[model samples]
Target: MNLTTFLVYCVIVTFTPGPTNIVILSSVQHSSMRQAMNYVLGATMAFGLLLGASAILNRMLAGILPSILSTMQIVGCLYMLYLAYQIFRMGSAESLEQHPSGFASGLLMQFVNPKVILFTLTVIPSYVLPYYSSPLILMVFVIIITVIGFLAFATWLIFGSVFRSFLLNHQRAANTIMALFLVYSAVMVSGLL
Candidate 1:
């Protein structure tokens, strides 16, 4: 693989705004850095697991990718909509108290997050597999991708931390914007656009 191309794809996908990142930002804004970090840890684990699975099952998945992708898209879209609703309703820290942004929620979110699912599924085959077939190499790539993902989540958390005051002052507006972004993400990934 062209290292530059692979790095670019990985960075672009993970760093871009998505459901996970939005939630991380929201978590930091509404909760605490500890909560955001917990979510990031879970997300990082799930990301690594997905990449490992992709690398191991590349050939088998190729035969059934269409079915899998369609199913995932449906599930992912619905989940995203649910998250959007939750975000839309979270106007205050009190409201967010009931909302879960912990490790389990973060792990579950990745499984149903289209942006993450698609990236994990495609990145390995498109970039890593083509260039390296060794299990060791594949594992290394997975670790690298997971680290990138962790960094992306961390960046979002830091952003929210930096703007916590503004976000708290405009809590309703911030929630609305994040909710709308999640909705837009859902629509875009639903194959309806």
Candidate 2:
């Protein structure tokens, strides 16, 4: 396997300004560190499971993906819209108590995330398959990428936490920026981006 290329792709896709990362940042800015960590754990675990499932069902995925891909995209788009609305409504605690999206929500959110599915499908076939097609190796790669994904979440969370003071001082600007990212993510998922 092209370890450098795969790792680079993983880092870009996992850490980029997508729905999950934006939400993690927003969560840290609006809520507690612990709350954001819950989301990270949930997203990380769900992504791992999805990656493994995709690798194991690679052959079947080709046929199944076409049928379900649009539906997943639509669901993810709508969910992103909802999240965008939530972020837009964010304000001071006294004016608007913005609660972090909980662990279960984060876990379920990963299932319909277009980026995750697309990455799993494309990366396994394009990168991993050429090197090793064994089930064991695929599973290992899935686990590795999942851990990488978790680190991505941690990075975003830290980025947000670092800006906690700035966000507190300029809550409206922060919320608007985060909300815009979510809307951009929705557009990307809907294939308009």
Candidate 3:
């Protein structure tokens, strides 16, 4: 196992703009720091859970991955579109409160987020499992990957926080861009790209 290759892949995939990152950016721009942190915490937990599940069930999942992926794709696409609509019309405290970017939503989002789903499912099997089959080793890799995911989420929050003022100043434009990104993500995950 080439450590550099694994590290690079993990970094690139996690750090890239995806549904979760975009939502984090939107959360920071439209909500408070506490709210964003809640979302981050939820996302991190779900990410860790997914990684652990993948590590333990990789072999079992191999046979049914196709069917599961198909269902996930549809659910994920619909969910993303719903999020896009919410962001696109973001205004007023009622709307913000109604669509709170909190822990529960963040946790649920990861379960259906195809980008994250694919990454968590494939990374271990590709990079860790082949090299180390021991339960202890796999657990260590899962923790490491989870940390990477948490870092990625935190980075997006920081970025959004840093640009919060600018984003607020151009709220409509910012929301539009973020919504568009989410739509693009939905399309890509839908296998239409």
Off by over 4 Å in 2: 59-99, 161-193
Model 1 lDDT, residue 22, Cα: 69
- Highest-scoring model, lDDT: 3
lDDT of each: 0.72, 0.69, 0.73
For model 2 the local lDDT of residue 58 reads: 64
Q: lDDT: which is higher, 1 or 3?
A: 3
lDDT of 3: 0.73
Clashes of each: 0, 0, 0
Better of 2 and 3 by TM-score: 3
Candidate 2: Cα lDDT at 56: 72
Q: Indicate the residue-level lDDT of 60 in model 2.
A: 51
Q: Against the true structure, what is every candidate's RMSD?
A: 7.1, 7.6, 7.6
Instruction: Give the lDDT of residue 171 in candidate 2.
Output: 70
Error of 1 at 179 (Å): 20
What is the Å distance of residue 83 in model 2 from its true position?
20
